[model samples]
Target: MSAEIWTGVRERVLALAESPGVEKVFGFPYGGTPLEDPLTEEELADLERYCGVRLPDEYRDFLLHVGAGGAGPTYGVFPVRRDADGAWQWHGDGGDMTLPKRLAEPFRQHVNPEELDALLADQPDEEAYEDIDDYDTANDAWEERLFATLWSDDHTVGAICLCHLGCAQRQWLVVSGPERGRMWDDARCDYVDLEPLGVTFAQWYLNWLTEAEKTAGTVSPSETR
Candidate 1:
């Protein structure tokens, strides 16, 4: 990937905040603040040391040169901060999928995006069966499994939820394991399942910046592809 990608992302990211219907609750009156300044080298080191893993360089550069946390894709990027006890942390989804765990452990890549739709596409519609109880027993097992794993932290074991895209969709950036720097869409809650976008941190961030421009008038929707 071109190293200059982050610079282009910065320009496009500013345009994103102006898009309509984006509920930016942080960094102003009422919500917890978002970071504005670039993180210092020492600060980055402190963060990595606390997390027990080094962040992807592109992501680190984005955090150091572009912006720390506030003002990013959809609901905005998760902020990195230190807690009251002085433990460095990533402030997002306090579930088991998140912090205070072993980060070097490889993340399990379970679902392939291409097969995701087909996996549930065959699910029988409720009205297909005359008896609801019959459908519940025979037709609903796979659907039930989908829901079970949807909320399971194991699905996104080594990734952090970066931003929520509404309608039960969210973007996650891997921090450790085999996909240490890739991004994915976690839509398991809605049965869409996990889909890897095959983009790195810089490209993923660029994806949103570009999408925001397409949404706004500054750039045409077709230009993004």
Candidate 2:
């Protein structure tokens, strides 16, 4: 993730975005316009301060050197956005994932299904409820909390949606904690599991680009898994 490596990544990504064949494959409209410029240092700083954490080094290099958005990968890399409340969030629409407050915390590398089971253990099982309606009411509340914990923004929490892989799938970059600088493929739609890709942002970006170069238009969301 050296600056030199990122400089090379920036050039290759820029080249790919500008390539005519890429346009034919991904079909993302650029309106025959050029890519945007790198984000200002001040802008990056303000984002970090608002999020209460520094971005991973490779990603920081990317936004500072590479274009802020509009290039690379399947659906193209998404730009960072701030809402009126100054909350840092990304709404890819292709896949909607939150940028959580715990993004500043060290990320969790893996999620344990057993942990969720433990949470359910805190509540009485359906058998514990004599009345079916009562059981439904109690379980609904617990189920809501269960889903929230599963998707929380701490360790094992998703950081950012780096790109939309299409078909309601996404490639996420880990920003907080143990997985802090790695890439993950979220391919739950095909009954496939969430899979890890490269360890850093640079590697992940290059891997996607390389895939596209080798076989244009063959790239799909499931490929990342």
Best-matching candidate per TM-score? 2
**How far is each candidate from the true structure, as Cα RMSD in Å?**
6.6, 6.6
- Per residue, candidate 2 scores C-alpha lDDT tens digits across 1-225 of 455655555555555555656645452435643345777898789888877788888888888887666566667777776679876665465324655565676655445667655775777588888999999998888867665655444434537776777787778888886777788887644424457785688886667566765555433332445
RMSD in angstroms, candidate 1? 6.6
- Cα deviation of 87 in candidate 1 (Å)? 2.3
TM-score of 1: 0.66
Q: What is the lDDT of residue 39 in candidate 1?
A: 83
Q: Which runs of model 1 end up more than 4 angstroms from their true locations? A: 1-4, 8-35, 92-97, 111-148, 214-225
Q: Which ten residues in a row have the lowest lDDT in candidate 2?
A: 215-224
Which pairs clash in model 2?
106-177, 107-176, 107-177, 108-155, 108-156
